[model samples]
Target: MSTNRELLFKYRKEGISDAVIYFALEECNGFDHLLLSQNLDKDIKDENRFVDAMNHYINGEMIEYVFNKAYFLSKHFYVDNNVLIPRQETEQLVLNSAKLIREMFGDKPIKIADVCTGSGAIGISIADVFKNNKVVLTDISNEALSVAKKNGEGLNNVSYLQGDMLEPLIKNDEKLDVILCNPPYIEDIKTIDEKTWKQEPHLALIAMPCTLFYEKVLKDFRRIMNEKYLLAFEIGEDMEEALTKLVKQYCEDAEFYFEKDMYDKTRFLYIKSANSYTNN
Candidate 1:
């Protein structure tokens, strides 16, 4: 086996990016180049410690697991195999939901529920923005709940529950003012990229189909949503037409329909229940 010293030299010569270098330092425990290149103005020799770090990196010990940190807005949250890593798309869901809340309610405190609250990313972010508003974060997995519990512990006006999405809200008698979800929307699990399918939690990323959860949410809204409640959901790619059909079928009188995160392939949909109620 080549010595760590020789390996370090080769990787540095290859010129790896800073991010990969960061993981190399993190996963390898220590890189020999930085550790060994201590002399002021002394240029390290070719095929030095840096090369070894990159070699170890490509051999793949550093990425044995998924990324452990997820950044949302200003803060960082811890994630692991048991919890689905929060994605930028889900963050968009939260931001768009908050915007709808402000547009409809004008800064007033309202009850909000975030279903399938993995890592508590969506709910925590929404709660952070609406300081006075209350948020209930719900999930079915205890492992996922544990992650949310830690992420949400110090956030003001945030609540955590371990149960199926709507079940916990039913027990709490919360007819929410807003309901936001990034539920498992992929209908055919095989259709997703192999890398993501392997890395993410299936329970958190897969469901009967793209529109399945929306159908279930329709039932949930019928049971728990009130005239004043607003519902927002993140849909799979190209799912707006089908999801819109479902919403129109069930929520015919909703005041207006809006799409958020327009930059994304599939945007989130917000239906204003109060608008529907008032239109009657």
Candidate 2:
């Protein structure tokens, strides 16, 4: 005997966003005008699912995880605790990476890899956008790879590999024109909100030395890089100076570019050697 307004109020009281509450309600029960109308407060019939969903939300479970699917670039991607939830900021990563791919490689065939490809959101979304590119999605966790594979189903241009970063690519003798990664760049897990930290996979969120994985990618995986390689990362906002030093140590000649997110945080890094590609 719960009215829609009551349910909405309940969710808002628990600090859930109106959009997320709406999404949860819609997923639980199809939207009805009476449900959203202030004047027509009536008990919702058979809203057990809605009640359960609300409980989950109130308990700090991410709405996307509750739904088991997330919308990325207008596509639905399967997700769970095995992977990190896709964020709007990462959509920017996809958009810019797609633009760069088109600019550097044209419409011709190209090889790319998505490292730390949780839920296959980045690699799958990229492949869906750039049809001519063959993308290999790599994750160290088998469970994460399984989740990614489910999201990547029916995408013929995508392949899955289970190894840390570019290790699978190196073993397969694959050289890529681009390598994109949303690595674990969090220097301290304690800094994150308890609610979110409880729900997301810790391995996908925290890195011991923060730049440990990034450093490994630049140093050990240099063999699998193509002539006109583009290396991009969704970086921690404060990693510019540290990453700059690492880039100098491992890839001193590569041109480095940093991109700010909508909040003006330094959120991305683009490293490439245009001169090598142009000369060749």
User: How high is the CA lDDT of each candidate model?
Assistant: 0.70, 0.84
**Model 2 error, position 12 (Å):** 3.8
Which pairs of residues collide in model 2?
A: none
Off-target runs (Cα >4 Å) in candidate 2 are 1-10, 13-15, 30-46, 276-280
Q: How far is candidate 1 from the true structure (C-alpha RMSD, Å)?
A: 6.1
TM-score attained by model 2: 0.90
lDDT of 1 by residue, 110-184 (tens): 788888888888888888878898899999999998889888877879988888768888887777778888888
Model 2 C-alpha lDDT per residue in residues 1-280, reported as the tens digit of each score: 7776688897788788888877766666555334545332556544798788778877778889988978788887888888888888999999998888777777778889999999888999898988878999999999999999998888899999998777788899997888999999887877998867888898898887999999989996579987678888999989999999998898877888899999999999988865734633
Candidate closest to the true structure, highest TM-score: 2
RMSD of each predicted structure? 6.1, 3.1
